[model samples]
Structures are given as structure tokens and as C-alpha cells.
Target: MTLNWDNCPAVSRSSDVMSGAVVFAGTRVPVSALFENIEGGATIDDFLSWFEGVTKEQVNEVLEFATSSLAPA
Candidate 1:
């Protein structure tokens, strides 16, 4: 499986946005925030509720991309 960032359409990074942090498309929410919240015991639903604009589909695509990238090649 290819591990290119293009696989995740909902995630992007631009020098003009949050200092080029990988953030959700069209939003300033950094992707790390999701992982940090989850690592702290926050559920996916809780994340969605707290952070608007990020759709479930976007999260699913990002997670799927991560899983595939981590899988043994």
C-alpha cells in the first residue's frame, strides 16, 4: 500500500495556515489535536462534537490512511 499524504484529502498543510501544520482541510484544527484528545481518553464522538467542520467521513479517511500506512508492506 502506498503511504502518501494524498490519500487523505481531508488533511492538508499550507505555509499560510497555522505555520504549515497538518490541519483539517478548510479549518485550522490541527490533526494532532485529534490524536491528543483521543490519547487522553476522548472518544471519536466526543471529538466530533467538540470540533465542528470535521466530518466523520474525514476522520474515517484519515484513520484508514493511517492504518494502511502502518500495515506491513
Candidate 2:
């Protein structure tokens, strides 16, 4: 399947995609979920436990996408 960033589910802050909320492109798992897990002393294993469908690669991609979105133009 093709990934379309435009259709991806995202939350914005001040019209900036970087400062906004980001959920799974298709699923409802918020990118912040991963951060929340780590902040709560949850390991990678624990994060996967809560979001079985999310992969480590996906988490990385989300961060990368967010970074690019915020990069100075």
C-alpha cells in the first residue's frame, strides 16, 4: 500500500505539523503513546505490549517525519 502523508491522521498545533499530535498514519495509536510509555518507565517491550501493532521502525519513521515537517524551509 502506498503511504500518503496528506491522508495520514495528524494533529496540528499553530498550523505546524511538527508541534502537533501525530497518530499512526492509519491507526489510532498516537505517536506520543511511545513517549508516554518511556516516561512511565516502560521499556520497548512494554510499549509493544500496549501497542502490539506498532513496530519500532514505525516509531522511528514518525519521529523522522515530524522532524522533516518542522525543518526550516
Q: Pick the candidate with the highest TM-score.
A: 1
lDDT of 1 by residue, 1-73 (tens): 3346765898998899999888888888888888899899999999999998998888887888788889878
lDDT of each: 0.84, 0.61
Clashing pairs in 2: none
Best by lDDT: 1
Error of 2 at 6 (Å): 8.2
- Clash tally for model 1: 0
Model 2 alpha-carbon drift over 4 Å, by segment: 1-21, 63-73
lDDT of candidate 1 vs native?
0.84
- What is the RMSD, in Å, between candidate 1 and the native fold over all Cα? 2.7
Q: State model 2's lDDT.
A: 0.61
Lowest lDDT 10-residue stretch of candidate 2 = 7-16
TM-score of each: 0.88, 0.51
